[model samples]
Target: MSLQGEPAHVLIVCTGNVCRSPFIERVLAALLPTDAGVVVSSAGTGALVGRPMEPLAAAQTERYAGSPAGFAARQLVPGIVDSADLVLTATRRHRGEVASLHPRALSYAFTLGDFADLVSGVTPEDVAAFGESGAEGARPRIRALVRAVAARRGLNPPLEASQVDIVDPFRGDETRFEAMAQQVMGVLPTVARALVP
Candidate 1:
């Protein structure tokens, strides 16, 4: 069900941008094929602007087959949210921040783990059907998928905060960074598959 034109931009957000979001961004980049028409990027709600990814987080990125090369932290802005077709934030709090910046984004923005859970039950056929019903091109298909996920909200049990929020590992130890990687990677592969499979 992968579409090939009109790339869909996916923005990942977190507090510092040097840890969770960047790592998730790189790992997702690695998981998705280059021509999948899905572009993954990251930003921070309160960024350490222009800083490279935290050393430990970069290590985790490499461990997961994702390169940490040349990543620069950037602050989240209204324009960034407005440009994105999908937004996956590190926490529910980050999701709230995105909605504040672009009220319309509430339709497509989601916590990374929460999005993983919601999209898990959506099959490739479902995505194809969604794509068929939307306007032409990959971006429309992505928008269709987002609409489908949003429609399913509240049909399932609520996810606890701990289940969806990836903890910040900017100043934490190796173990903390490892936990962040574990939390993100656990759900992200499912998300990638849903986006491109």
Candidate 2:
């Protein structure tokens, strides 16, 4: 998440980038502090690069805080995985893609809901005990949060299906897309509030 005290960077990945990843990325960006300098970006394991978000997902984001005017799908790259502090994949398959590409990333990377489940168990005291490296900006606090969650690797209980993967809604099914959006919207704000100071 950091090198030389830089802001934490998050990379979200899905199958096509045109749907779930873009929607989730924008929502997280909107939830975090702009000044905190948290970098949130999305990509696809097999992305439709240069394509805008799928219509159904775009509509969902519009209902929230994102604008479809500036989104473009992109394929995942090793560099993106290397730079990310937290790599949240839309599915276990996507997470496997990231790990197979970079074994060292296995610790920091997770499925979106998997990450939520892990972080949900981290109490405020755990964050405090991770050490305060001067309480000014969010980078330290965020790093602490990530560290805390990472520490819970084997300690926390396993996750249920609904908390480990977001169903892809790119099949031209608006109803499925809405359900996916609800899942993401419900989880991301809690994550942002925990990591953002």
The prediction achieving the highest lDDT against the true structure is 1
lDDT of 1 by residue, 1-197 (tens): 55656888999999989999999999999999877888999999999999999999999999999999999999999999999999999999999999999999999999998889999877666666666554666688788888788877897787999999998888999999999999898899899987874
Off by over 4 Å in 1: 1-3, 132-134
Please give the clash total of every predicted structure, in order: 0, 0
How does each model score on lDDT? 0.90, 0.83
List the pairs of residues colliding in candidate 1. Answer: none
As a TM-score, model 1 comes out at 0.94
Q: Model 1 Cα displacement at 159 (Å)?
A: 0.7
Candidate 2: global Cα-lDDT? 0.83
Pick out the ten consecutive residues of candidate 2 with the lowest summed lDDT: 1-10
